[model samples]
Target: MTVKSKKYHISGERLEELQQIAEENMFMHASQLNDWRGKLNIFVKGEGVWVEDAKGKKYLDSLGGLWYKAAGYGRKEIADAVYNQMTQIESSPSGSATISQIELAGKIANLYPEKSSRSFFVSGGAEAVETAVKMAKKFSILNGKPGAYKVLSRRYSYHGGTAMAVSLGGAKTADPMGPTMPGAIHVTNWNSYRLPYSGDPVDVAIKCANEFEEVIKHQGPDTVAAIIAEPVSAAFGIQIPPQEYWQRLREIADKYDVLLIADEVITGFGRLGEYFGPMNWGVQPDITTVAKALTSGYAPLGAAIATKKVADAFTGGPEETFTHLITFGGHPSACAAALANLEIFEKEDLVGNSKKMGNYLFEKLLELKKYDIVGDVRGGLGLLAAVEFVADKKEKVAFPASAKLAQKLPKFLFDRNIVTFRAGDIISICPPLSITKNEIDYLVDAIEDSIIHLKKDLNT
Candidate 1:
């Protein structure tokens, strides 16, 4: 699994210029750009599962450009669609309707559950989450439950980065951003790898579901607007709950007369072997938020889809407008790109490929458990998976936070011309759906090599 590095050159002056611009103006997200400074590797191009840095070094992008890129990279069809749409209509007012937007909405609505036939466009996943939250609150009020404003989310769930989305997120990512939006309640997450209770998986799931019911009861069910959750909690280490878990959650939400919002930003648009995660789990959420793979990372676009009943709530007089709106909610070019991306998905049967390739990748990843440092390999049914490292496999003891394996492992893989993501001690491998069997082998080999190297370096 050796990575062949190619020698390429970029003008030193051009590199310095880019560095100067970044240092002077660019405020990076979730990054210490200042520390990176001039040493940062700038990717200039991408094709399929690979991206090339300015230095012409190619790296296999296992994370699929932050868990997007379902159609892989460098798709001329998507680009041409965007270009054609831009030429016809560069921009339209938020309130104004466009053909591309309407068509995209129809396509997405048809893919969703039968009840979910309405779509509200947004720029990205965070915006989609924000839109879903707003719709939930509005729907509650419209339905005569004005007190239903609280949203229940699972602990360690990652929604988005916007203030409202961050508040809805159960992770500690927004701790430093000051107090979260009021009424954002947190409950236990379903991470079997680090289960709080030692018992049968079903029993633990029931207990977790009971916790949700308890929270709703405590909060007063009438005051709860929605229970938002990711079908497969990707940010919390790809925690795939049992099928019973989702069924129970659906029942609980129904019992409390609360809307269920599935934040499918990661698992939507064929990432999880199905059209959507809810379909995969056989639970139909009242509202589903989608982004990322919607346009396959070729453009920024997201959608907040609602059941017909929910959408009908806002269809009254002129004054009954859904007040929540973004200036670029349904940019025509983005919608065109999304439509073209979906076309590729249909033509190439990428969803089917995701299911097949995902199973193969999962099987290969399990081989990593042979290593002493590889604590767990969790994933299947989709093109998403993670490898959790441990200091003691027998006791399931995790490495100290100071070890910084999460930060170090990605770098080690990057140096070897392989790109992946690390969350805490877990390394997430989510390649494009188009990735082949040989690429999966390459990815797993790189991961194993990096872990072995780190073990010796840390003398673990």
Candidate 2:
């Protein structure tokens, strides 16, 4: 089979359009544009984990387009699948029936810990979370707890940007958008290293679970429908909860009749070395929402996977139906892309690679404790980890957000041909699972250099 080799040089007319588009569209992106010093650098292409700007500068792409792009840029397999699917059937509403939608849902549902869990498709993480929130509320209302609409989530935890998702999020940046959905409550997250509570990690996890009960009691469990959390908090520092956290939380949720929703947008599809994040913690959520790695960002796709019990609540002999629908949910092209992407994951054993390489990255980062600015490193197997910077290690005091160290670190590494994500003061690394040990070493070395330069710049 002979494949056509297409040149990617930009024509004069297209170049002008690109420039015009940037200028005319500049105001619409005013917020991000302002942060970019009045000009946006347009990117032309990507391959593997690298992206090239219009100016021809290549970046290692650690941020991975806000932690999407799992299989990395230009995976011909995914691209081919998407192209073929689009040519055949671009899209249609999954309106109560669609063949591709059903098959894709089955594929996703099997990925869950529960064999009988049902799946609902969505466009992205925020939508998946939003759907879960709606499901939880509607289920509670229909299940004899009309007052159970409140949700409890951890502080600094980020579920998404949608109204209800934002409400469930604990991240400071996520809030202040406006008055959020009412009844969403905030609580402390699992950060044992930062909050030195004496005892076993499992014990600490149990304590955290107890805190949920306390909060529910204070607010009246009758009013709380669900408690949502990232199994391993991703955006607000990859804080891995103690071993017993999920188990205890599960028990508590069962006891209180409150649903547990695991927001696995970041931890799903091998980011955590497991097929799913909740499995790592040995607990299953009543509902699990995931995005990011779903189609490896090849196509916009996300999922709301629910236990059989939850699905049964809405699936009563066709008399009662769940009043929810997304126009592009389970879009044929996206579903085909997702199906292809999962095949790649299976063939490559990406999950296994993530576990092996994640351990390597974690152990390597622990060696950076010699640097005073390196307050702590947190994360779990494969592709997910964060290196937090601080002014005083003993005090665990983070650098002022204004210092821009987190933002600056990535740029410094970009200069040296490496890239990373900076979430506030923590330099986050969720490299594509395809990353090799050599690449991991390269990434770490660049990070180390950035730390040294930052320290010098700060001190001077």
Candidate 3:
């Protein structure tokens, strides 16, 4: 298979019309709108693991459209489901229950652990986080410990962009708005590669878990409502914690009586080869938030699943309502799309494929370490992996922030007809779960060639 050169271009009235739209009203996330207003590649279509720009140049969607789209693009099954649902009923208020919403919630409950059997729907990941946070606090209050309102989150973790979600997130980019929500505490992240202690992986994991315990102790466990974390830190460079890390954290949370909230927005729906991230680590969180692949990016939908114990707390009297709602929390069409997406996952054995392809991709990525610029290649649990670059691999020295290597690498790969994501110096490659071995090889080869070209261009 011959890879096409990046020579496609657009012009005339169509280009002008797009430029006007892009420049006039569109404000992209995490971007300098002024600088990127007109200087952006407009994607017109997507199919399988590839996407085409307005210029008709096709590129492999290695990041799965921001780590969603696990079932791949152009899924007509999901489209048809959404269409049929819209024909019947487009949406319903939170006060009312829709059939699609009820079915999706039940399906999600049955899919995850029995403990997390009740769910609250929301529009997206951020809203899910917001909902989870509020539930944790309210649960504490209802349980008679109103002081338990602080949330412990790890540094470099990203929950979402809402006020509460942003506060829970520890990423620098997630904090551009300056002040965060109150009572959001930060703790050490389980980045074994950059661990302060040098020892066995299990020992390092123990040490990391100890840090979390210490924070709870110092903050006074009685005052802490919950501990929110990603099973495999995705937005923060795919930081896969040691096997012992999650179990240890779960034990600590249980001991401290703190609710464990697993933000599986990126790790749920078989992205990690398991139904949920906590399941992948063999630890069930009290509350699990899911989005992204829940509907395989076919539609906007997210959910916060709570254990029966937690949900039961808000029940009893007729006046005992959760007291929160989102207008489109349970859109009938979105729920229908999600149901169809999960059906495809089961029929195609995409979860099993994620595990198999993830292993293959991990081994292929390890080959890149032979390059002087490649520092680390981590990720094997499932189809989520990353390639971290360094100016000095021996010392693990990162390039200066001003260099903006992370921002530049994506464009470089894009020019070579490969689409991946970058977080600072770490490049992430998470293709659709349905990707074939041939497609994986093409992605890895393109990444290698791009790194070689980048090193030469930088004279490194």
lDDT order of candidates, top first: 1, 3, 2
Using lDDT as the yardstick, the better of models 2 and 3 is 3
Q: In model 3, which runs have C-alpha deviations exceeding 4 angstroms? A: 1-11, 175-178, 401-404
lDDT, candidate 2, 373-450, per-residue tens: 899987556678888889889888878867877567767777777655454478788877887888788778878888
Q: Report how far residue 102 has shifted in candidate 3, in Å.
A: 1.0
Q: Which of 1 and 3 is ahead in TM-score?
A: 1
Q: Count the backbone clashes (under 3 Å) in each candidate.
A: 0, 2, 0
lDDT per residue as tens, model 1, 11-94: 478778987898888876677775467776688778899988776778999899999989999999999999999998888764
Q: Candidate 2 at 455: error in angstroms?
A: 1.7
Superposed by TM-score, candidate 3 places the C-alpha of residue 348 at a distance from the truth, in angstroms, of: 0.5
Compose the digit string of candidate 3's lDDT tens values, residues 59-94.
899989988989999999999999999998787654
Candidate 3's TM-score: 0.95
Report how far off residue 166 is in candidate 1 (Å): 1.2
Residue 128 of candidate 3: its Cα lDDT?
A: 92
Q: Which stretches of candidate 1 lie over 4 Å from their true place?
A: 1-9
